[model samples]
Structure formats: C-alpha cells, structure tokens
Target chain A: MKKAVPLYIGTAALCMVGFAYTLYQIFYVAPLAQAPLYYNQKIFYYHVPCAFMLFAAVITCGIASIKYLRKREERWDDVAFAAAEVAVMFGLIVLVTGVLWAKPAWDKWWVWDARLTSALLLWMTMLAYMLVRKYGGAGAERLAAGLGIFAMINIPLVYASTRLWKTNHPSANTVPSLDSSMRAALWLSVLLFTFFFILLLRLRIDAQRAERRLYRCREMALDAGLFE
Target chain B: MDFLQHVKTLAWKDIRVEFRSREIVYTMTFFAGMVVLLFSFAFLRESSAANGGMITDASLSPGFIWVAVLFSGTLGLSRTFDRERETGTMRGLLLSPMPRAAIFLGKAVGIFVMVLVVQAVVLPLVALFFDAPLFDHPLALLCLTLAGTLGFALVGSVFAAMLLKSGSREVLLPVVLYPILVPLFIAAIKGTATMMSGSMSETWFWIRFLLAYDLIFTVAALWTFEHLVIE
Candidate 1:
C-alpha cells in the first residue's frame, strides 16, 4: 500500500489535467446546443458522465455488498462503503448539474419527469444506506450490507420505471444522434470520469483498510495493558 | 412438512398473543383510520359544502388508502418484534429448532395479517371519508393490497429484525424501509387509482407489478434472514 502512493499521486495529476482539458473542450470545441438551450446546455457533457459514474458506483457497491454478506469479509465491506460514498458524490453532481441545466432550458429547477425521478430515487437509497451505516449502532455494517443487497434488487425496478412511464427528459436515443464534436467531448468526459472514480475508490479503500488496522492494533494493545 | 408446521406454529403464536390482547390490532386500526381522516381534513374544502362536504380533491383519493397503509404499516412493523425483544424471547427463538427462514416467514405472515385487518377498517373509513368507491372493484383492490402488504411485511420484517437490537430502530426503520419500498407504493397507489377509475384492464398491469415486487423481495427476505437476524 505504501508503494502505491506515487502511483496515486500520478493518477491524481492525470485526473487534474484530464478535467482541465475536458472543461476546455466543453467551452471552445463542442458545437452550440440547439436553439433554446444555447450555452447553458454545456452542463450535459459533465452531467451525463457523472450520471454514468453514479450508476457504475452503485453497481460496484451492490456487488461488493453481496460479496461481503456471502463471505463476511471486511475488505468487501470496505470496497462497498467506498463505492457507495463515490456514488453519493456523483449522484449529487448529476442532480445539481441536471437542475442547473433545467433552469436555463426547461425554465424550472425541477420537473417530475420519469428520468429525473428515477435518478432521485436511486440517490435517496444511496443516502439512506449512509444513514444506516452512521446511526444503526453496533451491527450497522451488517445492516448496511443487507440494504446494499436490497438496493441492488430495486435497481431493475428503477430502470424499468422510466421506460414504463412517460418521460419529459431527453430520451435514451438522444446520445446516439449527438453531433460528432459534442460526442467526442462527451466520450472524453466519460473516460476521464471513469478513471477519476476508480482512483478515488482505490484511495478510499486503502484509507479504510489502514484505519481498520490501526483500530485492531489499538485493541490488541489495550488487551495487553500496553499503557502500563 | 415439518418446516411448514414450524412456520405455522410460529405464526400462530404471534396471532394468538396479539388477538388476545387486541392491542396491536386496535391501535393500528385506529392509527390507520386517523391517517385517512386527517388527509380528508387537509384536502376537503368547505366551499364544496353545497354538495354536503363532498371530497373536492378526488385525484388523491387513491393515494389516501395507501398513505394510510404505509404510515400505519410502518407503525405496526416497528412493534411486531417488540414482544420478543422485551422478554428476551428472541434468544429462545434463535435457539429453537425452527430454521431461520421459518422465523422470518412466520413473523412476516403475522404482520401481513395485522395489516390486512387494519385495512379492513381503514378501507371503509377511507371510502366514507375520501368519497372514493374503493369497494366497487373489491377483487382488484384485494389483490393489490395483498401484494403490497406482503412485500411491505417481508422487507419490513428483515430490517426490523436487523434493527431489533439497535438503539434507534423506530426512526431508522422508515428511513431504511421507505426508499426500498417506494416502487411498491407507486405500483399499489397507481393500481388502486386505475381500479377506481373503472379501467379494469389497466389495473391488472399494476397488480402484476405489485406481485412481481412481492415475489422478488420474498426471496430476498428469506435469503437475508439467516444472515441478518443471527445474534
């Protein structure tokens, strides 16, 4: 883990550079969004990728959670916790950017559109997962693992709801018809966000692992009466 | 066969206890009725008094039944395991020969019945108060409520068991339960609304959705029971 510090620094630097390039591309290169949206539409590049990362993070948390429950492994719980925290951050980015773009394009900060509602529902579950971890007391980790599994089962329902109902948000096919330049910027943002998410997840897992080790060692010392 | 008996015996124990006291049944029924009553008070308009205080906000009529169910259902879920906790009977239950899944299913069955009983009174109260014909399509309404209540009970039982030993079970139950149960609520409320609107065919779709939700989570609750409920 110590040897990975330089690698972590290098990845952080790359993410910083990648984010800068993506911002530059968004402003100077990506073509103007259609009539009403204009420059305000630029949030789409960031918002869409963040939404993708949010889903990716949630799936990671779900899978790790299942593994943790099946094996009762602390590392799996660590990974699940890290992924869930990342999911929450990206969930916020998705909602905030989506809301910001809506203000300019849809003239409302919020709409009851199916897609928006779907995103909000998933985010709330993620938030609730964190709450259980924080205040659920002694067996909170196990309780959280159980929630992760249920949240995973709820995913298909969330996904299908948007399709089974009406949606005001741009439909799924909107991505395929994007102009080439905008598509380039969008893909680049997606790529950068993926790398950035993995680095953050890895760093968090390592930090949690370190924290667990310290706790264990302290407990051992207490048992041995090391303070005496 | 023995497993079935185990499940039955466990479920009967809870029913017999609650029925004898009539405490949970009475309190939950009252709470559910109050939910519907308050909703009417909030939404009813005095200007519609010309029609003898007709329900002016009928669009929400379908949701009122479920709102009552969801709220009182949470109340009942919080209390279902209280007796076990209070008497330290959970340890005895755990030590018994009954499989973990049996314990979960048994308790869930009891809670499901409790909710249905509450609904029996709450349903009439909602119809009389909200002025919706909840009983016009009795069979459809029954199927929707069964599926919804079953899903609610199964999920609620698992979490309630997990939080059984926690200090903050009451507050955390809804926070943890509602997000996961939102889909169930939507499907039930929508199905009720569809049935009340005289659309027989559309109501089936929501009924199927609720059943699917119930089926999937039943498996989930059973699977998680052994792992989650162990001391």
Candidate 2:
C-alpha cells in the first residue's frame, strides 16, 4: 500500500456511509408531507452538501495559494492544484444538481438569481484557473497559484451579491437553519461530501506527483543518452 | 520624489505607446459602441412604451449600464498586456528597476483612464439614443466612474498580466475577471445609476463598496504581483 492508503480508506469508508444515508433521506425516509416544499426533490440534500464542499475546496485552494506564494514550495502548488481541480468538479456538480433542483422547484431550468449567477461565475473562474494551469508551462505553478487566490476572491462576491442584489437566489444560511432530524441528516451529508472531496484531492495530488516523477525520470534518461 | 517620478514615467510610457498605436482605444470604443447599440436595439426598440420605460429605467438600473461597461472593458484588458507580450516587451519591463507594484498600479491607472474615456463617450451615446438623462449628477457619477474603473483596472490588470503569457490570452482574461468583478460592478453601477436617477441618498454605501473593492484588489495585486511576473 502507498503512503496515502490509510487516508484513502478512511475517507472512502466515511463517504460510503454518508452517501448511503443521503440516498435514504432523499428517496425513502423523507416525509411525503414535506414533498410539496421540496416536491419529492429532497435531492437538494446531496446538492447543498456538494455546494458547501465546493466552497470548502475553493477556500483550501486559496490557502494553498497563499502558502505557495509565501513559501514558494512546489508542494503547496501541487496541493493548490489538487484542491482547485476538486473545487471545479464539485462546482460542476453544484451547477448540475442545482439546475436539476431548479427545473422542478422553480419551473425553470435555470434562474439568473444572484446565487445561481454567482455560482456560475465561480464555476467559470475555476475553469479558467484550470486552463491557466494547463497552459502556464514552467510558470504554471505560480501562475495557477495567483489565479487560485484571485478565484477565491469571488466567493465573498458571490455571497454578497446575493444579499445586495434583488435576485431570487436563496440566501446562504446565516446559521444552519435545519431542525434536529434534518440537521442530523444534512450534517451527515456534508461530512460525507467532505470525505469524498478529500479522497478526490488526494488521488489527484498522487497522480500529479506521479506525473512529475515521470517527467523527471525522462529528463534523467535523456541526459544519460539512454535512447540513443 | 524619485518613486513618484518612476510612476509618472511608466504611466506616460504606457499612454504614449498606446497613443502611437491607438489600436487599444479604438478597439475598446468600437466594441463598447457595438454592445450599447445592440442592447438598445434589442431591449429598447424604435417606438414603444417598453422602449420609453427602458430608456428611463436604464440609468436607474445600474446593472444594465455596468454590465455593458464591464463586458466591453475586457477588450481593453486583454489588449493592455497582450500587446506587451505580442511585442516581447513585457519581459524587458519586468527586468527594469521600477517596483512591481508601481508597474501594476501605473498600468492599471492608464487602463482606468482609457476605460473612463470610453465610458464618457459611450454613456452619452447611450443616453442620446435611448433618451435617458444620465448627466443628472455629473460630478457624483464621475466619482463613481473613477472609483469603479479604478477597481476594475486593478483586478483586470493582474489578470491581464497573468494571461499575457498564456496561450489563449483573450479567452482566459475575462474568464478569470468577470466573476471577481461582479461585486465591484454591482456596487459602482448601482451607485452611478442611483445618483443619475436622483437617488444620491445611498452614496455613502456605494462609495464604501467601491473603496473596499479598490483597496482589497490593489493590496492583493501588489502582494502577488512579484510572484506573478518575477518568474
């Protein structure tokens, strides 16, 4: 087993259990009376958790960005890249699931409400960050780190725009606004998604390191004239 | 005294270079004109009550004008640094003695000035075509424009710097900037629109938002600029 096996196992186990419970809440255990409110669309349990995880991943990206800038460590860049990639994945999930929820709940596939628009903006920024990394070359680490910090700056903007503008977007909970049963279920979902994010990030980081190692090996072999 | 001299020299160099080419300003103004014209035709038809409402309402709703401005502003952004990269001059400037912050700020202020000039021309054209009265509070509107443009230029400059060396400079600049700029545009345009519509009572809040936007991004750009351009 690799050095990351324990973390992988722990996260996979936690996520599996949480995902199972989330499925139960969305499909089986959720009350039919509450269906009108969500209209058998309690899949928002999964959606909202993913949204939170997306935010958490972006924040971590920002932290890693700062670390890279301050320390100039390639590791921090690696971690930042991992977090940003995960944020993009989770952000895409939020967008898709939110659109899914919106179609049934709002009778429209998408609304230009502040929350949705801001979320879309965030998704665009994440995609841009990934692109910057893909093409940035020798300067990729620093360039992507700079963009990661810049992208994180959008989160607060997204939050504030929802408040300042007259959009139909739901205001983020000032405090977790769920009752006991709902809160327990919601927290579990969030925990599970966080674990999933961790697993994905670790896997991404490992792949990146492996890629880096292969490049270094190729460079060494070429220098040794192994091919010739 | 010497630091101020460096700032002035760099600003002048950028402006002078831009003048010699004038392509940046021309492209930006032309694009801004097209956008406003398109929106006018789309939303404000030749004759209708809806047109009348849109004309009167456009300035009142800063969202419309600011968005037009923001989208068009990207034209200036990609060109600002993209020109330098095209000519292979960005690295030469980076090798100069000017502080990176000064380079960042000077380029920003130059672009802000350029964008404001475009807005100055475009806003009146928008008003004339739509029959909207935009000069109701010219001074206050100017203040909002300056503050808003400064913030946009600040953030835009950093992204432009980062994208200058990237493959798809045009595509990447707006992708990184549009979302981060949402709040700045929202607050500034709201302030401008409100002032134009005789709603200056909310001036303080908008001013604060503008100032906050400028401060945060200026500090952020200054802090990270060295990391960005220093290789």
> Which residue pairs show backbone clashes in model 1?
none
Question: How far off is residue B173 in model 1, in Å?
Answer: 0.5
Please give the fraction of native interface contacts (Cα pairs under 8 Å between A and B) kept by each candidate: 0.68, 0.55
Alpha-carbon lDDT, every model: 0.88, 0.77
Docking class of 1: medium
Interface RMSD, per-candidate values to 1 decimal: 1.2, 2.1
Q: What's the TM for model 1?
A: 0.97
- How big is the positional error of residue B205 in model 2, measured in Å on the Cα after superposition? 2.3
TM-score of each: 0.97, 0.90
Clashing residue pairs in all predictions, respectively, total: 0, 1
Pairs that collide in candidate 2 are A35-A39
Where is the poorest 10-residue window by lDDT in model 1 chain B?
Answer: B47-56
Q: Which stretches of candidate 2 lie over 4 Å from their true place?
A: A25-35, A38-41, A167-177, B49-64, B86-88
lDDT by residue for model 2 (A1-228), tens: 287798788778877877877778756655442444455356667788888888888889999999999998877888999998998888899999898888766778987777787677777777878887776555767777887897787677656645666666555672275555566666778777877888898898888888888999999999999966
B69-163 per-residue lDDT for model 1 (tens digits): 88898888888788899999998999998899999989999999999998888878777766677888889988988988998999999999999
